[model samples]
Target: MKLTKTLTSLLLAGTMMLPGAAMAETTLNFVSWQVGEKGYGDWWNAVIAEFEATHPDVKIDFTLVPRDGYTDAMITQFAAGAPPDIVHLTSFEYQTFADNGWLEDLGPWIEKSGMDLDGWAGQGACVWKGTTNCIMLLYFGYIMAYNEQLLEEGGVAVPTTWDEYLAAARATTFDRDGDGIKDVYGTGVHLATANSSYTNDVLIYVLSAGGRWTNKDGQVTINTPETIEGINRWRTIVEEELTPMGMVGGDIDQLFMEGKVALRIQGPWINGFVQRAEPGIKEHLKYAASPLQPPLGGSSNVITLASETPQEKKELAWEFIQLATSQKFQELYSELGASPAPRPGAVNEAAFAAVPHMQLLIDATNAASAAGVDRIPTGLEAQNNEFAKVAAEEFQRMLIEKLPTEETAAAIQAEAEMLQ
Candidate 1:
């Protein structure tokens, strides 16, 4: 009787094992640009942990690639018909992917799943032709970090208008050694490439001057009178007013580190680096909102996200993106002083609580978010950058060498047509 009971128990165990074997495992692969940097991969891991905990039947696999080759790598993977289950797409690169029919239509997913994409600042960037191919994960703003002591020494008030900014730039620049040659520059011009890489600041300038890149019909309207004038103004700043820093396309981040430049229009990622590099400069540092046109006619500042992802994974990508761009995550990032939230309400309370001056930035973000629009980052991105480069270089050459404005404007126009 004991032997019979043992055989019956063995048979039951075998039957239970069959069901376990039949259960299928679902694994989702996520690709992002986070290979070399330490602590950068933490967010992805945290999200994965949260996702795995909630969905026990599914698994997540993360693939970190270098930021330099991120877009190319994604393209290669997507072309193989085995793209990742999720991808990080920048606003600037989204256009190329959308143009190629590589992305999935996320409109149905958002409508059916009831995701809260409306509150995010980057929602516009994710939408192409009224369809969302990817969800925005974060918002990064670029501002000029100024040296307070130097400003006071130069008797300059913090600039609010373009005129004030130009004057401040002039006052900030002077030869410290009393030599005929000017040794120090008041403003730094990041005259690298003009593409999406080099145009964020210019975008701020153009928009502040009431320039628009496109009409409601999604046609390229880059050659408008206001745009031409805006480009001319940028050229003037680079050529005649500010000292040229000559930072390469990808080297702007490093240039701001040395603190040699008095005013650097750069991103928030450099905040911690500056504090660590020159602890004494903490009290002396201040951030300025990008300049607005006088008489209150400045358009909102916008950002470009570059990404290449496929359709099937877009739904999951949006969920992951929502998590990354949520108010909770934005505050977490703010606490670390990495970057601020893309949305107006997100991270603002904590940001203002941490630093009073941050209120201005938050206000600006709110205003901009309310007014901003999203456009495709066409393949013309490279052309635009090259055109800006030529114009900037020419403006610099003319200003430093005292060339004519008409000649500079002509060169800028000629180069701009090539971008079309």
Candidate 2:
């Protein structure tokens, strides 16, 4: 009887120990394209460390995907029924994912937590069919970065209007070594169709001219007078030989660093690239808001629907998203990435004080309009890609085939209507 009692006592002790020893732990997978990028990777690691410290039972499994194949990889993973719990998707990809019901609707969580969304730059991109599906982490607006030395040599001040921009470009383009061949161009233009840069660059021109791809009701409005005017203006720049021919976005950056381009329209990432490639050129770099209102640029963090199977895991994923979008993390992101924060007032003033040129980017974001991709209806990723493809082809024709601006605009509009 005593031996039986001792066994019972041992069993009770084992149960007590098991309750504490078998503590449930959750692990979340986070996928991002910025894993090895200079400042971005370090900042993300720091955030993960802090989050892990607070939630000791939770482990974050980070997966780094290269930018070139990131979207395809994410899609493949989702199709395989094993998407990461959290994802960083670009604005262009957000709507498609939300439309397919692949993303979690964050509205209820935000409402329950009473998270304020006011004054968050580029937040409109996260809303799909009146449901918030993502949280914007980075916000960038198009701005013009000029080489001060080139502008000074050409005796031209910074251009603020379309006409002035053309004049400056004309003045800045010339032969430097008297070789009778122009060695430097006034601006670096990207017209390739393999990437989205062509579409984005063209949209900047269209948006600045007060043209839009669609109306508030989502009708096709690409063949408007304003759009034609914008396209014509762009053609004139090329016709005047102000930009190098057949270049892509990466080539533009290279030309700018080599001092072959006097002015280039780019986002905040240019600052980091310039600092790393040509630090000496930093002294001559000056930034200005795009001649007209620029398009918004950035990405957002989203929770995937795969996490919904388990309520606890879903809640934990949401917690991480909240932590990432919190003001503290936003400030850290802006400081380290040199990009503008998604939310206004989330940037550290002292950080910008050291790089005053970045202030122009902040101001531009405040004054910018939504990008073309953001303005389209949800679930139209395929249609959108088709539209971009057609538009890019027509744009290339305008540049190389010398197609008339009206014809190009009409072609794009017809393609857009066909998709509709």
**Candidate 2 on 370-410: residue-level lDDT in tens?**
44334233334436655766787878777778777888788
lDDT by residue for model 1 over 1-420, one digit each (tens)?
Answer: 444637755765576688554334467776666533323355457666776776554577777775555667867877776667665666666555667676767667667867666656656656667767666555544556777776776788888777887787788777677887655555665564433444545555666666655545544555567765665666666766465556652354433444444666555544554555456655677777756531111112222222344433454555665566566765655544445555555565666666454654455444554554322223343343344456556655665787665666566555655566
Please list the residue runs of candidate 1 whose C-alpha ends up more than 4 Å from where it truly belongs after superposition: 1-73, 80-84, 139-142, 174-184, 215-225, 267-276, 293-319, 325-327, 333-345, 369-420
Q: After superposition, how far is residue 25 of candidate 1 from its true place, in Å?
A: 11
Judge candidate 1 at residue 127 and give its lDDT: 62
Candidate 1 local distance difference test against the native: 0.56
Pairs of colliding residues, candidate 2 = none
TM-score of each: 0.68, 0.81
Give each model's whole-structure lDDT: 0.56, 0.71
Off by over 4 Å in 2: 1-27, 38-42, 53-69, 112-114, 174-183, 239-241, 293-313, 369-382
